[model samples]
Target: MAWLSPAFPVGGFSYSAGMESAVVEGHVGDGDGVEAWLGVLLAHGGLRNDAILLAEAHRVQGEGQSLEEIISLATALASSAERHAETTRLGEAFVKAAAAWPHPVIDVLVGPVPYGVAVGAVAAAHGVDRVDAIAAFLHAQISQYVSVAIRLGVIGQTRGVSILAASEAPILDAASSYARLDLDDLGSATIIADTLSMRHEIQYSRLFQS
Candidate 1:
């Protein structure tokens, strides 16, 4: 459960998924805009990609294979400095956290793996079944994104929780369906997210690393 804690210190608060840039461009100027953006991210972009990656990672770890190749792939396909930085930084942090409270499954995952992969590994270590692990992983992301949304001052705390509550079924459904996916079926192409992350590079008034 430590991994699910918002206080786990993964630097999650630092990124706003280009919300700053969007707001500055007047694309997300109010609470409705923020809610809509959060909804899109939860349904089609952020959570979807992460859920697929983590579920695949869980299935792989559960089968007792090394995650070296997948970890490298996740990082390489990260697409932007902020994206890369977010995954690797959290990967390293997960490693350190795992070391302090060693679990055999997670101990085998001791290196830079993507956040999704590492969480899946740890969930396996803690004896969570595959589907539940993926659900938990997505749940954590929903909470984190909402937390960041709060920091963005785009919505109040109640609104953030409401957004998360509204998203629970979709995220779990995604996890259930996605957890069954094999690597061959594993892919994400959320172009707007990638573009926003790329545009984040040039945004002078940015509130996020990406």
Candidate 2:
């Protein structure tokens, strides 16, 4: 819980994972819209792929295996440059803060670990249950997207929390299923989100990183 919390210093608050662009484009303009956007991410987007990566990282660490390939794949799977920067920067920060748990896996993270891999590997080293960790990670991700909506004036705080409340089922569904997935299952279909992230790179009046 602490690892994925808002105050964990991962800077997750500063990046919207392309939701900022979605909001500006009027694709997500209200509470229900935010919820639907999140549903897409949970079911078929970067979030789903991240869960697969996290689960793979958890299994790799639990089995005392190298994370080199996971790290590379996670980086490669990023749909845009800003997306790549967001995951890697947040991952490096997560590894730095997660050092409080004192694990050898933390030491092996030489550079630019993807956020999911960092969280999953460190959680495995600390004996966190795989499904629970993935659930928390997914919850954190969705919460960040909701926060982005709130900050963008698309939804009020009460509506933000309401969306979060409505999101629990999808979060659990993705987490439970994704915890068993392998890298072969890693793929995303959120083309608009990915395209918006690239568009965000050139958006003149951006409020978030990506």
Candidate 3:
């Protein structure tokens, strides 16, 4: 639940991961667009690609699997310089909060533990099973996307929440399937979002950090 709360001090509020660009282009500035974008994320790239990795990381932590491999795979899969900084930033935050739990693996993978791996580790420490842990991670992800979109003025609270509400089943379905996929299958194709992130780099004026 800590990971899902928007109030968590992970600096997640500052980054949009390119939603600003999409908004500027009028492509994602409304409910329909938000639905479409989130649908695409759930149906294709973001959900399966990234959420699966999160699930795997959780399972690894649960089953006494290899931390090295999990971290390596997660790092490789967690692309985007800004997004990487974003995830690592949150991971670092969680590290501080999770100190009392004292997982050696968490200590070792402290700095850039790949968002998924870190989330999984934290979930395990908190005694959440891998599946539920993945659900929380995926829920947080979709919520963040919606939150960023709202910050971009692409949607209002009702629409933003509707977008999240609409995405729940797909996110859960995809996450469940993804949890069973291999790291070799991990990859994202969020072209517009990724490009928007690049565009956010040069956007003359913007409200988001990307």
Candidate 4:
């Protein structure tokens, strides 16, 4: 829980996952819209991809598999430049912070890494269960976007909680399925979310990074 907390210093708050542009473009105008949009993202897009990566990373670490190859593929799978930057930047920060606390696996990881890979590495190093780690990672991602929704005024505090509550079943189902899959299963179909992320890169005036 500590690693996934908003105060963990991963700079998650700075990235909106394209929600800012979605709000600006009027795709997500209210709490209900925010819920619907998030549902798709959680089910088919970046969140799904992240979950698969996290699960694979955890599995590899536990099985004594190669971290380098996993990191390489995870980096290449990023759907957009901003998405790549967001994961790599947060991953670098996560690795540095994990190093400070001292973990054997952390010392082995060198160079750039993806956020999901970093999370799996650290969790495995700490002997955390794969299911628990995946759940935390998904929760953190969901919370970050929900926080963005609140900041964008698309959802009130109460509404944000409601949306989260509504997401519990889907999050569990996705996490469970992803945990059982291999890295080759990684894929995303959130076109609008990806478009929003791309559009955010050149958005004239933006409140978030990506």
Best by lDDT: 2
What does candidate 3's lDDT look like per residue over 1-210, in tens digits?
A: 866577666766777666778888777767898788777766665556667677777777777777778777666655566666666777777666667566676666656776667777778766877777777777887788888887766678988877778777886777667777766776667787766767777789987677
**Which residues of candidate 4, in runs, are more than 4 Å off?**
none
The candidate 4 region of ten consecutive residues with least summed lDDT is 100-109
What CA root-mean-square deviation does each model show from the true structure? Answer: 2.1, 0.7, 2.1, 1.2
lDDT of 4 by residue, 1-210 (tens): 888898788899999988899999999999989888888887888888888888888878888878988899999988779989999999988888777668778877777899999999889878998878888889888888999999988889999999889888888887778888886777778888898899999999988889
- The segments of candidate 3 whose C-alpha lies over 4 angstroms from its true place after superposition are none
lDDT, candidate 2, 1-210, per-residue tens? 999989899999899999999988888888888899999989999999999999999999999999999999998888899999999999999999988888888789879999999999998999999999999999999999888888899989999899889889888887899998998887888899999999999998988988
TM-score of each: 0.88, 0.98, 0.88, 0.96
Candidate 1 lDDT for residue 106? 56
Per TM-score, the best of the predicted structures is 2
Candidate lDDT values, in order: 0.72, 0.92, 0.72, 0.87
Q: Check candidate 1 and list the clashing pairs.
A: none
Arrange candidates by lDDT, highest first: which order?
2, 4, 1, 3
